[model samples]
Target: MPSSINPGATLVLTGVTHILVGLTHPRLGPPLLSMVRSGLFDSITGISLDPTSSGAPQYDRMAAWWFELAGAAMILLGISIRENINVAGYVPRGVAWGTLGVGVIGALVQPLSGCWTLIAQGIWMVGWFGKTKME
Candidate 1:
């Protein structure tokens, strides 16, 4: 089997999951109105309490979005590692394991429905480990 095939497919799938869920979750979530009023597009680049000062729920929504983006980036890093891309100090195998922890920790803060994502993350982490020959 080609080295790139496993991680390539995994990262692409994971990347799509993160990107789509992150982008759509805000509009489909509790803070839709607040996010739209506060310029949701800009918020993705950076977030401050000013936009979500209405309440804590709004802040949680933003935090979830940030995590989605970060997850996507981590997937890319994992794929890059498999490809042997020179990424300074990052190791893809480490990134893969680290994201599992992130997903587990996220469940503590996420709503019940959000636990599905965590479960999927856990499954993917285990699947990635078993499927990839990444060192």
Candidate 2:
């Protein structure tokens, strides 16, 4: 009758996976460093293609920046979930709903992404199995 899923652990694992995936990009360093150095305001210009250059240099930079940023964010989310669970003995319903909302949006925007896992995690945390308080 009990669910095998541990939402907190799952979130943490997801975060770790995200970070690892981001690290796999060969040229993520310069772009990420540039964003950091400029307080990310410089990134507002977005990706601009150089007519003189070939290939997807600009696109790759932007992609790496976003991938790394998302990975860091996911890690933070996992930490928040774990801490909340530790202190409250359960993930708040609001957090579950929020995750579900984000998951839905992400899934809609990028159907091939791992947002479905977030959706599943949200549903599990929402106490469909009658585990959480749902308050």
Candidate 3:
């Protein structure tokens, strides 16, 4: 309960960045565009990616898929949190703390990743500057 926090914007921006990364990925971008062009009209059922596959192409697809999915999830989470804050006037402490813990653990494992953003969001949520009203 310290002060200023704008978690929504942070999460959204991070998500957008991740999505862009996935879209621009050299190996995955072409296939992604092809899928989009096809309108995903074709059935994509029963498609299983073998995690054990060691081929460079298989790994690239896996990485790209996970990246895009995570980005989408972040966007969804941000929108949901924003809506909740709009209605409740505050983010739950559990959410803030949870994000902080996640950030810390993720950053520990991958110091160069976006976990830093999560860390900042958590810090802001818990207490950083001043509490601002959601616009």
**Candidate 1 per-residue C-alpha lDDT over 2-118 given as tens digits, one digit per residue, 9 for 90 to 100:** 444443445556667766676567454445445667787754433355774442344555666665676577577656655642223223456556656666776777755454454
- Alpha-carbon lDDT of model 2: 0.71
Candidate 1 Cα RMSD (Å): 6.6
Best-to-worst order by TM-score is 3, 2, 1
How does residue 87 of candidate 2 score in lDDT? 51
lDDT of 3: 0.70
As for candidate 3, its clashing pairs are 3-130, 3-131, 4-130, 4-131
Q: List residue ranges in candidate 3 displaced over 4 A.
A: 1-5, 27-57, 128-135
Predict model 1's lDDT versus the native: 0.54
Top lDDT prediction, candidate number: 2
RMSD of every candidate to native, in Å, equals 6.6, 6.6, 5.3
Instruction: Evaluate residue 95 in candidate 3 and report its C-alpha lDDT on the 0 to 100 scale.
Output: 74
- Give the distance in Å from residue 32's predicted Cα in candidate 1 to where it truly belongs: 8.5
TM-score of 3: 0.69
